[model samples]
Target: MGRIVAKVTVANPVDKSKSRTFDALVDTGASMLTLPTNWKKDLGDLAETRIAKVEFADQNIREIEICGPVSIQIEGFQKIFSEVAFLEMNTSDGMYEPLIGYIPLEQSGILVDMLGHRLKAAKYLDLK
Candidate 1:
């Protein structure tokens, strides 16, 4: 298996001035954009909030804070509208570990090149 990571910029749709760009893990298993709760505050005010039950890799299902209406842009890709999940995760090495889910990738028409460990823009989005 290979790891896919990319630099992602997340900004509140209402206020694009407040944004953050950093390296994030491309996780196909993740249902949506997941960021550390610490950064959520910097995004200013989001449009809405929701609670979702997420099953972690440990097999424990827990409720999570999901905030949204943000613009997600991967370097060299068009921005896409999507919600974000504020999660409680600790990085032992003191680094930001945001996870980019499949939703934004599909929405942006970007595909993960696991073999090349890069992102490829699709010529056409699938209807099926």
Candidate 2:
């Protein structure tokens, strides 16, 4: 398997007018979208909050803050994620860019092509 990357846009659901575009790592190992703590201001005021326990590959666990609903755009699709975690770790700790995880990938109907190192839309069965 290879690393899948995509260009994504993150915005404040409350005010879509406020948003930022950037490249994000598409990580299936992650369950939720994660943005750098510095993006807090650009994401606008968070209306809700949650605590998430993140387990690293080394079996280390850490609790982090989650806030949303955030509007995320990928390719031509868009969805409002109810919660997004703000990574408090420093850039040196490998938290350099945003991460698009499984939740948003499934919600946005994005399919990962590992061999191609790209993302494609998941096809839905047309019952009609």
Candidate 3:
């Protein structure tokens, strides 16, 4: 599968007025959204904090800081989730600043097209 990248907007859940847009890597392997630790200031007053154990591809586990209840927006869909993780990355590598994970994609009804390296809204099945 090719890399899928998209622009994402993150806002403070309490005050929707505060928000920031950044490029994010759409990671199917990841379970939750993660942003840089420096973005905490822009996010403004994260409502919660906890330690999260993250295992990388090589099976290296690390305890990282997680903060929460931020609003995430992609394409035209948006949702205020209860939690998001934060970690530091090497800016020199030119990697995407934020990582959009599976949970957010599922929550926002987004479908990933690996062959096209893009994202699309999932169609809901209407039984009614």
Clashes of each: 0, 0, 0
- Encode model 3's per-residue lDDT on 49-116: one tens digit a residue: 78878998889888778887787887676554657888776698765468889888888888889878
lDDT per residue as tens, model 2, 1-128: 66777888888877887888888888888888888888788777886587878897789898888987888887676565657888775767664767888888888878888878888777972335
lDDT of 1 by residue, 89-118 (tens): 878888978888888888989988888888
- The residue ranges of model 1 lying beyond 4 angstroms of the native Cα positions read none
Strongest candidate by TM-score: 1
Q: What Cα-based lDDT does every candidate model obtain? A: 0.88, 0.79, 0.80
- Candidate 3 residue pairs that clash: none
Winner on TM-score between 1 and 3 is 1
Q: By how many angstroms RMSD does model 3 differ from the true structure?
A: 2.9
Candidate order (TM-score): 1, 3, 2
Model 2 scores a C-alpha lDDT of 0.79
Q: Quick one: best lDDT, which candidate? A: 1
